[model samples]
Target: MAWALGANSNSPPFAPAIGANAISTMRAAFLIGIFAAAGALTQGGAISETVGADLIGGVTITPLAASTGLLVAASFMIFGVYSGYPVPAAFATTGALVGVGLSLGGDPAFGTYQRIGTFWLLVPPMSGGLAYVTATLLRREEVPETVGVPLLAAVVGAILANIRLGVIPHPERAQGSLAEAASFAVGRPLVAGVDVVAILATVVVAAVGFRYIRAKTQVSAEQGIRTFLLILGSVVAFSSGGSQVGLATGPLENLYSVELGLPSIILLGIGALGILAGAWMGAPRLLQATSREYAQLGARRSIAALVPGFIIAQVAIALGIPISFNNIIISGVIGGGLAAGSAGVSRRKIGVTLAFWVITLVMSIAIGFGLYRLLSTVLGIQ
Candidate 1:
């Protein structure tokens, strides 16, 4: 599961940077591995809880069921990665889980499904629309480079400031944002105004950073933009790790109840290793597919696409939602492609990709259900 997810999820975050030549494929893989592992260790709990514990009711995911579901989902993802079409790992995992759950006589958690479904429906349009607007504004001659770039940077910084990190005070219980951590340190109560303050502070810091980068004679504006793109990609990679790790580890959470049960941290560590391996070994092909096949994006458009991808990813993580990084990045790419004109985009490819997304979900569910029943009845296990 980890290997499959690592391959699928780790590539998109760094694909833009690789595509823009801001970073090499190997370096991107290394950074992705590091940041993703950090994210998994620190912030992978919430979504893991949701996937393992909240998706189905009246049944605990048995070891056999968990392994079977993960194996099926991973196999599908592996096939996609090698075939140069990135499958939605979340859909595959969710479908497989639901399939296995139903086989075990578990009822659907409709409320949870509603929430997940809503996010799945919203991500493409929302991220794509936001990217379109941002890309359009950045391309406008009226919007000066000095004004536009810093504004976008400020928005990113504000999001960063408010994003919850797992290494805060109550690491075992709840997460904490940078603002909340600062507030606690200074002996200030976490009032409603703290968010506003954090945003303002982050904006100032971003503006200063942008100004410094722009002022450097050694660094051209294009170089500065590339640097920013790399940063955005890295941040998004980290967020991907946090969000994607849960999908792999959630089913394994059931193992904790057995006699030789591993701890949550250990499971997370194992998942992190899988993600790292996937990033190193399997991410390059899909990265190329997304970065080149989907759209031709320059540094500016790449940055625009990644900004929304990062934001949407963080939002999903915060809500304990499992999302496809491929969907997010591709939507952003399409949005960026539209800014240049539809001539740069491939309509047929997009159509096929969308169809596969729907097919994978339904197929995984059916396969999982059938496979579980076959295994149980044939082996007389469970």
Candidate 2:
């Protein structure tokens, strides 16, 4: 989680110098390259596969179109990162793809649009509600660190265990339980991952419960709650990376893989680098704008804003839906603030942002359609 936050927070300060040279600039560039590369290795393959194979109606993107989309999206991100408010990379890129596809006279892929819309709509409320419930629960007298943190950790651990070890019907990959993984390393009878998972969960719960019972100090309780929030933040960030990277590159997948004969992996590598650049150059200003211009968000409030953004972003990535991180973050901030109190949320800001969203989508679509027609006409070919 810390790593994820660091990635998000540190990026805006380093990206510009990717084109420069200095000990610090070179180091920043190198780290950016490394993370982008690592992200490609970690997330690129699955994302590229889905984008290339899943996002169309038997369509093969033209090389001209793919390169055009990639260049267009990349240019937009750089512009946002350096000058304009950081528009969501997901929105810009996805919009470009849709634009290009429509330009080619392809019917709107409603199924894909529907899925993306649903996730975008669902993420903010769900994450905010969860964060609220978690926050409220920690405020109660009956929770303490040993009990709360460990219990939450155990739950997280169990999910990780199950997701990793459980056998899927299709993939045939061995999904070992966390407990099983731990036991296997020491040559123990493989604990049924589920049973071991349950036991671990119980122990964590008991520890937290006892600590709450023994609460002799207020500071201890506060420490425990912060730890829990930190853990939640971490979980949200890592999951987000997996889901959000696709927005940075999914549109060009068919162009790179099918049209240009580049490996999907290479396409992904390019996309990840683009995202890393977007984050480093663009995100901070947007973050500042949201943190201050949209609403005053202290750490507690910011957590409310960020948790939902992360959840929505991840869902977008998981399903191969392109969306703006800023859009998600801002929307989540609005919802979260509304949940806290309607007074603090600014109506004008919301109106302007929403209006921008509509304009961005419409303009991108129009431009794409117009450009396609112009190209086809000039070439005297379809």
Which portions of model 2 miss their true places by more than 4 Å? 1-40, 75-79, 82-84, 132-237, 255-263, 308-316, 376-382
Report the Cα lDDT for residue 33, model 2: 38
Q: Which ten residues in a row have the lowest lDDT in candidate 2?
A: 14-23
Clashing pairs in 1: none
State residue 307's C-alpha deviation in candidate 2, in Å: 3.8
Question: Residue 241, candidate 1: how far off, in angstroms?
Answer: 0.4
> Against the true structure, whose lDDT is highest?
1
Give one digit per residue, the lDDT tens place, for model 1 in 1-382: 8888888877888887777778887788788888887788777888898889888899999988888889889988999899988899899999999999999889999999999999999999998898898889889999877667766766777787778876776434578877666655655544664555555556666666566545531346676677778878888888898999999999888786353566688888888899989888888788888887888787778887899999998889888998888899889988977998988778988998999999999999999999999998998985
| Candidate that would win on TM-score | 1
Listed per model in order, the count of residue pairs whose N, CA or C atoms clash below 3 Å is 0, 10
lDDT, candidate 2, 54-103, per-residue tens = 44454555655555555555555555444435445555555666777767
Candidate 1: deviation at residue 294, Å?
0.6
Name the regions of candidate 1 deviating beyond 4 angstroms: 171-173, 190-219, 257-262
Provide the lDDT at 337 for model 2: 58
